[model samples]
Target: MAEGKVDPVHQFTIEPLFGTDHLSLAGYNIAFTNSALWMAITAFVLIVFVGGGAKQALVPGRWQMAVESFTGFVDDLLRANIGASGRAYLPYVFSLFMFILFANMLGLLPLALVGLHPFTPTSHFTVTGVLAIISFSIVLIRGFTKHGFHFFSLFVPHGTPLAMIPIIFPIELISFMVRPFSLGLRLFVAMMAGHVLLEVLSGFVISGTNAGALTFGIAALPSFLLMVGICALELLVAGIQAYVFALLTCVYLNDAENLH
Candidate 1:
């Protein structure tokens, strides 16, 4: 029983929720993963919010009010950045915001509940990289569609000297590509590092019992405090990351529309 009670930090072994052997799908085995579960939950919640809000009343209920607030906020953000032109992309932006917001928030829940899974998809570079690639593709396609081949002019700054074209163009192109990489990495690293720190501190608390009551108490205090601070920070980061993503999208759209 004592052995069974080993702290999770000490037993950091992760077992895949879905195994290839279980599915026997030859080269393609899709197992039900915890990350998949949370993503589904996020999608369901988003649908409910949007669907419920569409049937608005004079006196809205809690869910309706909540949805309204988010919609209003996103609408205002779009109006400010892209003016009336941004209206068409509101649904996509809102969905992006809500999905990421929920993903970050859900990740902060206790490990025993949401974080115990073998695969943290958000922490995985592949997941974030894919999301980044999708956003990049959207920007490129929209820009080209709206501005014709002139969209390539984005790689050349407005006042760039003719002689500097070789140097500046490559730099601008690299910078554009870096946008998605930085966006995805920022969120993934924050989520992964915060959780890992919490787990490490928790391990200290669990393992220090044999030391003295004072030792355990001292070890626990900072850990608890850090956890609380990080939780608050995570909440703020969730919104900020979502906003940054949307803002970048808008900027890319603006470039597409203006061919700048």
Candidate 2:
């Protein structure tokens, strides 16, 4: 890092929106942070969707149609993977998708344009880790409740030899246990990498602008173009990642209930 260069990781810093960022009670720092603000914003957006769509217009206006279409998409997704039983979990699955989708897309928008910093909560491991943990917990509780001891069979190979059961069991168990970590890491890394790359390329343009017109024309121009392309790609990634996460949830739920 040099002077006039942007720190790619600076965006991920958790700063307090209000004056005092630090407030400790009983040895635990419970200060409100930027991450909390974004989460609140995410919640507010969801509230608007729920409230705004409450009308259930007969003909359906533009915003209403948009809301209904998104809901239908999530419904279709759940039904496709988990079948009719998935409807019961639609609220959880849809909320997860919308929150991530909004966070991801909102993170791409320039703060200057929207008067809001595009801080992505999903880019942080803690946020995504909690989501993974919840998904994992659901798998455990529902799997066991639905099928009892048979849920353990998820780790047992369908056609493995009796002698190899001892060897295969541990490997499968480890893989099953690591699902949450893998899920969280995948989303966090993807988001963080894209944002870092965007920052780095924008830094190049900034440095090029300061150098001279020649450098700005040659280096900054191409860098800016690439940044634009990457921004477009990130938009696609935001939706795809959200869908992937939700789909995986349904798949895991399917495994828990059906035990395949």
Give each model's whole-structure lDDT. Answer: 0.71, 0.88
Q: Per-residue lDDT for 170 in model 2?
A: 97
Please report the candidate that would top TM-score against the real structure.
Answer: 2
Cα lDDT of model 1 overall? 0.71
All candidates' TM-scores?
Answer: 0.85, 0.94
- Write the residue-wise lDDT of candidate 1 on 1-260 in tens digits: 12223443333333345453345357675555566666777778678767988766889888788889998988887787778988888888787777777777766666666436433456655666777777778788888888777887899999999999999999999998898898788767766776677666666656554456896678766666777887788678767777777777777666665665
Give residue 209's error in model 1 in angstroms: 3.6
Residue pairs of candidate 2 with colliding backbone atoms: none
CA deviation > 4 Å runs, candidate 2 = 1-3, 24-26, 114-116
- Candidate 2, residues 85-184, lDDT tens digits: the string is 9998899989988998988887777884656676899999999999988988998999999999988888887998999999999999999998899888
Per-residue error (Å), model 2, residue 81: 1.1
